[model samples]
Target: MEGILNAVVLFSNFVLIPGMAYGSQLALGALGVTLIYSILRFANFAHGDLMAFGTMFVILITWWLQSIGVGIDPLPTALLALPFGMAAAIAISLLSDRFVYRFYRRNKSPAVIFVIVSIGVMFLMNGLVRVIIGPNDQEFGDGARFLIKVREFKEATGLNEGLALKLSQGLTIAVTFVVVIALFWFLQKSRTGKAMRAYSDNEDLALLSGVNPDKVVIVAWVIAGSLATIAGTLYGLDKSFKPFTYFQLLLPIFAAAIVGGIGHPVGAVVGGYVVAFSEVTVTYAYKKFLIYLVPESWEPESLVQLLSTEYKFAVSFVILVVVLLVRPTGIFKGKVL
Candidate 1:
């Protein structure tokens, strides 16, 4: 009974809640990538920067709002400013597509060329964000900090182990769920969204059927902008917002997009959770918790963390490698393009 109880607690603490929250974040981020990939037809390396920029906008707005004593009661007022952040991102994306990408599209440039172009766009966006934000960590998310505390959990459950769930995490999950559902509904049911999917499925057929590639691409960018803002802001709320953090996130975002199957919206969500769970599980130290379950004599003479937090990035790459070796198309038949 003791062993069973310990195992159940360990599983819950190390896997269940953390995985869901982290997965939600990944899914949100991956959705933006998948949308851009489907319409833009390239692996956008700069998406991470877009995420950074969006969160920065939210952080700035939050700080400004807080300074004026205007805060959302019960919930973080940053939620109120998220739309503005999203709008800023959308406007920027539209401008970028027009000035930086429209010519290439008109000239019928190769996908590889577009990929290289994205690198340039990424550099430009990165520089622009750093310049505007001054390359410093910004903290703006505030209000209703924690839904539950570890002490409360212990008192409520009468368990040796307890976990705290931040209000930010809860809000992040709820908002992400709503956004993802809305996105899927748009893609699967809305007329324009279906048209976009048709284009993604077969560009020639879509064009033959009178699909306006430009319009569809613009819509994709709009949706991607919204997603990026939400992902970046929520992540900043849950973790911390650092301009450079987005640069590091690009590889994992790529891994998530590929893992879930590129160009597939559903795949992106799955891949996000996969990446999140892998990172959390591998890096989370289990030694302290395990000692409670195992007898002293049986406890191994070493820490049980699969990998240290410093190697968290490696976890994503390793998963990607295995996925490619076993199933290049991803577990869900993501985009071959």
Candidate 2:
């Protein structure tokens, strides 16, 4: 009885908490991609790089701030530097929109061509980040490494299960909530946001109705940039910041967006959490937790993880394919067709 109880506790601590935090991060990242796809009318292969660039910006600012002996007291100073990073990302997004995407758009290129252009832009951005940040990992987010210690929780709870949640994870969820609420309010309630939606629904009608298409596109990019920065910084703060890791993250982000239903903001949020949980749960060895749930005679010799650690990405891809097959529209009724 005690052993089974212990396993359950351990699983809750190790699997659920980490998964929730990661899902929040991926959801935020996917939201940015979905927004761009809706407004820009292309699958932005460069988005992953945009996230990388934003994190790189934060890394740079964090280094500068640390050099100046400036740091947040109880929280990571990178959180403080996030606004600047967000602005920088917005600028970059706008510039990319102007220089690369805008030209093709004006040329009346097919979306297939725009998709090709986006891939080129992705490579360019990847190279740019590599050149600037040198294809290296930069650890800049600092302060309050953990909000709770597992050992401490064990002492307090006196249970088999104990959780050690990070402050960055808490901040990521809180910030994501705030950002999501603000974003939805803007899209569902605000004028400019409604205008953008209108433009998305019918570009010609929006133009005829005196809605400035350029303004809407610019606004969408700005929002996308902000989301990219926020997601990147929070993720860096939670784990570590690596420029290349962001590129690698694109697969899961797409999975989340696609699984949650593309172009639906709420879906993006849900999709993020779903992907996060899937990644963690699939990779998490459940032996510790399951030992408590099953009798000794039933206890398997192996760790009960559904997939190996290295197969996390594979798990995400599988879930995405399954979701698409089961419900093409997505969990939140996002547009699949």
Instruction: Give the Cα lDDT of each candidate.
Output: 0.85, 0.84
Cα lDDT tens digits for candidate 1, 1-337: 6555766776776677777777787788888988888888888877888888777787778888888999877899889889889998888889999998899988998889998998898898899888988787777767888888878987887877776788888888898889889989999999999999999999999999999998998998999888988988888888888878877888777888889899999999989988988998888877776777778888766788899899999999999888888887886898765
Off by over 4 Å in 2: 1-5
Model 1 has an lDDT value of 0.85
| TM-score winner | 1
How much is the lDDT of residue 204 in candidate 2? 88
- lDDT, candidate 2, residue 26? 92
> Where is model 1 more than 4 Å wrong at Cα?
none
In model 2, which range of ten residues has the least summed lDDT?
1-10
Error of 2 at 270 (Å): 1.1
